[model samples]
Target: MGNNEYMQNAVTGWMVPHGEHSDIVMSTRIRLARNLRGFRFPIAFSDEQAEEIGKLVSDALLNGGKTGYAYTRMSDLKALGRQTLVEKHLISPQLADAVHYGAVLLSEDETVSIMVNEEDHLRIQCIYPGLQLENAYRKADETDNLLESRLPYAFDEEFGYLTSCPSNTGTGMRASVMVHLPALTMTKQINRIIPAVSRLGMVVRGSYGEGSEAPGNVYQVSNQLTLGKSEKEILAELANIVSRIIVHERKSRELLLGRSRLSLENRVFRALGTLSYARLLPSAEAARCLSDVRLGIDLGLIEDVDMNILNELMVFMQSGFLQNFEGGELTAEELDSSRAKLIRERLRQRAADGEPHPDEP
Candidate 1:
């Protein structure tokens, strides 16, 4: 599998949920930066060693690392670990070479998360489908074996690591879905939205929304009540918001989708549809094929086109009969012919229908 294709699958297949899990995700995660904390061990582990990695991490928590999660604060390591391993120059500052590359203090669970944080500390996030599925499977596994383990252990495995406040039970897991509502939500409305979301037992923050912010537009909302609320209630709320958000988003797109929008929308839908069938080939190769088509048009050698349509086209072309093309290399004649034909067809065929448009022509 190629990188781009893998990236695509990792996003669509693993990150975005399907069927019943749809509302569980806010959106694909966008990480803008990383906060790295290095650590060194005076001694390296042997080949035969089990590498008390988990224990060392647990014991090393005293160096002022806050809970790797937002909800899990420095004062609270109960959900993740007893402590986090983010001590910089905390030990033996005088011992110069006793350690290896300091271990990067990743998040509480050590799972990479992709969210942008403005703070000095770095954060990571995983896309919704990817992480949610993982947690779901773990929860199902733990529940399946409920008779064998202790209640606390089992619950923590399913929720956000057992919390003192029972509301955060069963893996302490809460998922939020987000929407970028700049058009629907004015700056004044944003202030109101926060308390509104919080009031619904949903949490909201800046774009990128849940964990951090990125340059891209996104807003996340996750469930707040873990124990009291049944999974059904949380999921229902997520679904409702997602539905409403989709309506708002569609309206926004309608307002913004321009002359070629209909064609572009069709093109994008085609690409997204094609993506699901790409498993027959290596994913990266598929992505590259799609990327080439996109980049070709983007470079202006292929033709004048909407980049968004191009992106969507990438997904469609991946699994189609002809899935590969670079956007570079459009000759003047080719451009003129395609453009003229496109324009003429639109004027003759569907422009007068008073329908939204058949812009692709």
Candidate 2:
């Protein structure tokens, strides 16, 4: 398929909300980093070798899959398109900006993506809506197995998977979940809970994973240690921790409603007021505002809004996605104005549908 078509097609069915805890648990992701037996890491590869590596992984991914599987050469896409993929979490920023050859194999559902020639020969990842760790891991393991049958991965007698990063040396697996913790943030409990989670061999990363800020009260919790543990053990441990966090978040929400209903509603309504009336909204402000509205929906204070729309806005309202959606570059002021306009339109449409808004009662 063509580039624009590929980008649009990749988003199909992928961003829709799913799972029982989907209101709070945004998504689950499992990634396995792997390199081929003889090929050098992406950084060490020459021009021709990088091309060969990309071809090898791309071809193998397409070998037995249906049309849902797509291969896109990173170099072929425009810079904006690559950034859009990054916003969608389908590819990494490093892979998007790779100098040498790089490509990605994406599932039609947009849940599975393999970054070829990214730090490793392959960075295979599976994403599922809501708190579905086991489901995400199942798909990731299947894809890894299928690829392994066609290509021999670099492995050591002592380590399971030989990766460029020492931390990913064994198992080479990273399991994470994106969650909304507005209650914790609103109650100032996140500060205390974060260090405790760190002690449990877990990390609370920003919304888009490492090195990003927790915009919209969204955080990604993932395993820190990958060495020495079996893949099954790692998944089990991460799942247990995530479940506990989910419980905590739910309880916190209940507490807020029980003891501080008026205050919570006031904050949610004030956010809605700014979002619907603002003429210019910065990316960060929009994220934080949308986060409150999303929490309102989760708590049944807002009936017109849906989690699916909130999830889509989480990505589409980003600066890169906004520029790409408009099909051209925008000045900083223009982007802010456009983001506000978009938010107003979305919230207005939902309001016009006759559902109860947070400000109504």
Candidate 3:
């Protein structure tokens, strides 16, 4: 790409924002989704002829892209008569109610986009507020938005903020694609092509990115270091990556389709809730869960739970219970100091039932 691309990306700072948070919060948010683009092959196959498109996407993502999610068209548990190929571990009990939104089974030549929510993300909205705020806000998303206001950088001592230069602050752009590049990473031709590839605006990192390592042997080329690059520069990089990704995607379209790609959307949330309540978890536990949360999103298994915020929030919410960490809460350990005693009380009759459950402490 040329400097014109970078120059075009340079724009004035005039973003209108939503939900007010300190700069620390604005800068600590993680990029949750990919700005998707797709390619269509010359030929299409009938639904009945498809056996493995979903697996194809899954393998490709697991091998090449940072994020991997699939759509399953297999029979549904509640359908008139069908059975899906997804494992029970891939399904979450909490989101069992929202399962419909969790998975999709697309036909041949179909495309899907991924989205994750940043709880209090601000978008520069135009034409909606008073003239002062009009057109000042960035678009609803990063690809089309502006970084109107940047907050100061801060860290969470308890949960530990994600540390890396050019951090993916507010509305960080998370671009993941389905690439069929098992050999591309090792090929000599590709080695020569990388410099040209990256100059267009991408970083060749592992599946997870800088914060975490790739789960398996997969390689990911995401865009995380663009603080100084202009919008056009970033877009050019994204477009270039999209172009290369299309080639790989097409190669795998035949072997992988009509299958599911995510594994832990609900479980991740449940884990979050569990971690939040399990005050016993130390800093390492919190850090591990943070990566787990990231895995859930990258694999298309989970939805919008900000790990950094969730981890810190867990400590804040449970600070009151740390005193009980010594042994037990006054309500239980103080009264009986024995598991048998607690269980026995729970099963006792009203007459034998004893002290109030709420005030036993």
Top candidate on TM-score is 2
TM-score of 3: 0.25
TM-score of 2: 0.93
Better of 1 and 3 by TM-score: 1
User: Model 3, range 56-110, lDDT digits (tens) per residue?
Assistant: 3333333443233344332343421111111111121222232232233221211
Candidate 3 minimal-lDDT segment of 10 residues: 80-89
lDDT of 3: 0.30
Compute each candidate's TM-score over C-alphas.
0.37, 0.93, 0.25
Q: Sort every candidate by lDDT, greatest first.
A: 2, 1, 3
**RMSD, model 1, all Cα superposed?**
16.0
133-159, model 1: which lDDT tens digit per residue? 344434333322331132112233244
Question: 257-356 in candidate 2: lDDT tens per residue?
Answer: 9999999999888888888788899998988988998899889887665556677777878878778767799999999988987777666555635654
Q: Point out where model 3 deviates above 4 Å.
A: 1-180, 185-196, 211-217, 228-233, 248-361
Considering every candidate listed, which one attains the maximal lDDT?
A: 2
The CA lDDT of each predicted structure is: 0.34, 0.84, 0.30
